[model samples]
Target chain A: MVFTTIVNCVRARGPDEFWRKRRIFKLAAHYIGRRRNCYTVAIKIVHRALVYATKGRQLRKQDITELRNARIIAGCEQHGLNFNDLREGLLRCNIMLNRKTLADLAAWEPYSFKALTDIAKQKTKEDGFGSVKDLQAPVGVITRGMSK
Target chain B: MSVLKRVQQWATFARIWHVYDATWQNPFQSAELLKKYLMGIHKPIYHPMNDCGDHVIVINSLDIALPGNEWAKRVYFHHTGYPGGATWTLAWELHRKDPTMILKKAVYNSMDGNLQRRYTMERLHIFPDGNVPPELMGNVSNQIRQIRPMPKRLDHYTKEEVEKFPKIIDYPKDYILR
Candidate 1:
């Protein structure tokens, strides 16, 4: 309930001392060397690792987005279409596709992507988009006017 | 896996044979297009570590077009590791020696220099002309569209179509014949 002397009172931290260090040790369990066993060392390393983990979460999303963009660009180049033109044309035609789905279509569904590119080209040609002024209109893309 | 699932898996992983007609197409541009198929980057399930590349049969490599003066200016350099072994061959000269070399080199250089490149290239069968072996041709189920439209030469136009084309003005009957 009370320390008999001032020295003993100052020396005592709490009954939960071992548990406090144990938590840090657990986080560093996989770490090699004294870092995994020593409480002070483990705590410092764990703090740095936690910071990296936090930053990595954001980086992972950016990496995926960049990869999807690269894949889409590669697909566009193959069909001789500008990446921006494809996106603009699709938007004008009311085809709402995000990068993730577009990337998937570009990769797995080659024929579908081909049709999309054709549609994009047709839309760009119809609208007389500046970038596509020289682009030849793709044939056989049946739009509403054609259907009627 | 069950029989249907097993078959589906096989179909998913099956190597597709793609035919590309390189007539009047730029080798560098064609290389960029073909690299995706060769590396299987077109597959939704593509992973750099996974081998999902397809087989591409490039035909009419001899007809590849070089933009500007690339035929004369482009050089293929090689060295034999001797004191004076460095040799630079003009594109046209190289093309004359090997009709398929330019396209092959284009495809090879287009891909990232990695351990997988050489092996991936082996899957690409290029012919100088559309003379693929029947066995190889039989495997082809897909034809990659040419990047640029082939231009029709004046001589190749049909007489009736040429005559039907709208004329802006009739040359004066008395206009001095060149």
Candidate 2:
């Protein structure tokens, strides 16, 4: 690698440039047109794509949380109980189930979810929580603090 | 697919008919609940591109309650794509003209205005009263609970139950009749 001037020799990055540009090219391999072939274009597009990929990871988590909340709300409404009351009642009962597990129970194990709603209803009745003022305590399920 | 797998697929995708009694229910709130069923969003297998929505049969739409002065204030607008062809109708007026119109409009408006909206709406069946046709009623296997409990009228309470309710305060001896 002969250089006509010292300035050109200093500017040339040598083998290190090949490996650096190759990394960006590898990342942009799936891209189309000149963006995939040219190092200059590939680096810019890859950087933008990486930004989107980073943001997408956060968005994916948010989307799953939203879906789980919707499923839980749907499950709550099915049993004539609102979401707040279910969560509050379960919390009061010391039964701490996360949204994902609760959603899974609601969708796949419906009978178990129904039992949870019953227990929740019973707890709400004992606590005299919202909307359960007129709701009768669920039969055959005596919750704690009921004998008081 | 094998017979067992085919049967499993059918069971997973089969559409269910849900019944909702709109008696004394707020139309707007009921619409939000019914929309979930109509779009099958409540199901675990729900997807925007999937055709898994269920049929919702709303009964006694004539008895829907509008909160506060909504019946007099809420207006329905219509235009006929001609000069001076706009008109507004109040909620009660529209309801009187068509008992099922308010609920139908509520459920329709609650959904997203996408290309699938029209087809999704076709799955909703609204009856002005409880006298649904036998064919439609036969398909209903689940009943969606009301958002609010029906207010019990004084006449609705049995004589013994009303009498059994404890009185809070007796009228003063010198209390004047209004």
Candidate 3:
């Protein structure tokens, strides 16, 4: 009951209250405002703090995947394959890939990803899926620490 | 092995193996061991004020084993509180997407970051794949030791503690597990 009341009170606060950079800016404020002696309040408050500290942990992979997508999108564009054509054509084509694995190989071994892309391009042309792009990537196109 | 000798062995092993095979994935599963291993508590070097500890590196993080239905019911949540204050994800989803991470996270969290925290951290090695840290493996030269099984552990709370989960309750019956 106190938690709900506290939450309600915090929610009642006007727009100006700087909610602690989170959605329920009020929950913390209400409990904090009153030096609640209740042991339950103290425990609940600490639990929420732990959740905040560890929150960044879960997002690490999503960020890495986003980086991979950027690299592939750039690679596709350079080869004259638009993102739309690449996305659609790659789907129907027999390419079995995921952004992470593809990006890893593309980064560590561009030639390999290029070779795969070349086959993909050929399939696209054969099936009349999209424009044929050059697979003759520049030599030494690889980057440091990219050898997957 | 004598309890004293066994304690010393565990400390050395904890420092050497960052990702222990038996209970590394869910550090919480063997939290008592991890804590003892990292704290140098098992050894006579046990000084509450002093920080004597070892580092560990874990390999085969993705292949880590789990023992119960916890992966389904457990939910990890975080919130930035801009518009949608809370974001929630399931433990199984987390494991399938990146199995190694959750264990790494769980181990790190259960660990106490005291004065010796960094030193203890130095011993921990967590790999997403089963790749061992070659440099650290060199330190584990003594094959005389076997891979010690982590003793099973679980968190126990007095029924009195569970009562306080809710901030306020008028009736004692409210806490009874429904």
Question: Largest TM-score belongs to which candidate?
Answer: 2
TM-score for the B chain of model 3: 0.57
Score candidate 3 by lDDT.
Answer: 0.56
DockQ of 2: 0.25
- Indicate the docking level reached by candidate 2: acceptable
How far is A9's C-alpha from truth in model 3 (Å)? 60
lDDT of 3 by residue, B40-83 (tens): 44432234453544444455567555558767887878799788
Interface RMSD of 3: 22.5
Candidate 3 - CAPRI tier?
incorrect
Weakest 10 consecutive residues of candidate 3 chain A by summed lDDT: A137-146
lDDT of 2: 0.89
Candidate 1, clashing residue pairs? A107-B42
- Ranked candidates (DockQ, high to low): 2, 1, 3
TM-scores of the candidates are 0.63, 0.64, 0.35
The weakest ten consecutive residues by lDDT in model 1 chain B span B41-50
Task: Give every collision pair in model 2.
Answer: none
Query: For residues B1-178, what per-residue lDDT tens digits would candidate 1 score against the true structure?
Result: 9999899779878999999999999999999989989998876556678798999999999999999999999999999999999999999999999999999999999998999999999999999998899999999999998999998998999999999999999999889977
| Model 2 ranges with Cα > 4 A deviation | A1-19, A38-44, A142-148, B1-13, B19-27, B43-51, B58-105, B113-118, B126-137, B143-178
lDDT of 2 by residue, B81-140 (tens): 899999999999999999999999999999989999999999999999989999999998
